[model samples]
Target: MNEQTVTRDERAGEEAADPNRLLPDEDPSSHDPDDARHWLEVYDELLDFKRKMLTIAEEALDGMRDKPARREVVDTDRRVLRAECDRFEKRLAFWRNRLAAARDGKGP
Candidate 1:
């Protein structure tokens, strides 16, 4: 949800109109992994939080990027952070996918 917008105009839709926004995607009466029904919501939040944090970090590093004194350091840090962010996104996506599959009637 960390869009490339210059500002945080899109509040990530964090505050759901429906308390249990994912409730529609889930069926509590089902004897499936409804117990793990919260997994998707949790994962989505985690990813959003992480993305926000990374955006802050990237912005900080970018501010340093223009300073000759910090260029070298920030350059390296930015690269490392981007790589780590990619890995983190992939890792979270895996679990999110599984949860989605389960919610959609596929096996967890």
Candidate 2:
């Protein structure tokens, strides 16, 4: 092929081999606003659940505190409830982190 023809072919090949040109990337944060909003809502719901669990745990402990005679039973129930509350609180924290990551355009 002539030098001009070879150059044109090489340019065409380079364009075809361009990865970004072939597969464009859409910003995760820009793909869907509704998706981000949905995640935020999920995080909020988890926070609400965590709050309710803590309240329940506090009530259980308060009840146990008032009754020394039934310490074993009350304490056991309180312990179980407190553990559950902790788990829910952790979940809330995780969701909050995920929401933050999404906002910052990072991984969830």
Candidate 3:
């Protein structure tokens, strides 16, 4: 198969694996507005929590600045926080897109 076909198959497999995956052609009218609102609120709260966690991670790294011996541990912590932040960002984007799609009467 060509690259595009392979990629499409892979994406399909991924969607199959992820129960929460939203299809582009899915009927948005079937979804409840109230549920969407609640999910938006929940996602907002999670994003806020992620921001707070990132702040705490930064503070922890700042505290470790004076202790050279623990630099490796701090670095590892920073990496973990960076990954967590990345995931949070992706999730936020997903929710924002989903909301927009719902508002536009399109699938997310």
Q: Order candidates by TM-score, high to low.
A: 3, 1, 2
Instruction: Report the candidate with higher TM-score, 1 versus 3.
Output: 3
Candidate 3 on 7-105: residue-level lDDT in tens? 998886455345354435433344555555655566567658767876886777766766864586466555555555565456556656667777788
Candidate 3 residue runs with Cα over 4 Å from true position: 1-32, 66-69
Candidate 2 C-alpha error for residue 14, in Å: 61
Worst lDDT run of 10 residues, candidate 1, spans: 12-21
Candidate 2 lDDT at 86 equals 53
TM-score of 1: 0.41
Per-residue lDDT of candidate 2, residues 1-89 (tens digit): 89999999888656533433211332233424455455446545754775676577566666555576458645554554455445445
- Give a tens-digit lDDT track for model 1, residues 2-107: 5566245343333222233333354433434544546445546655765776677666765564577467555554554455445445544555666566778787
Question: Which structure among the candidates has the greatest lDDT?
Answer: 3
For model 2 the TM-score comes to: 0.41
Please give the distance, in angstroms, between residue 47's alpha carbon in candidate 3 and its true position after superposition.
2.3
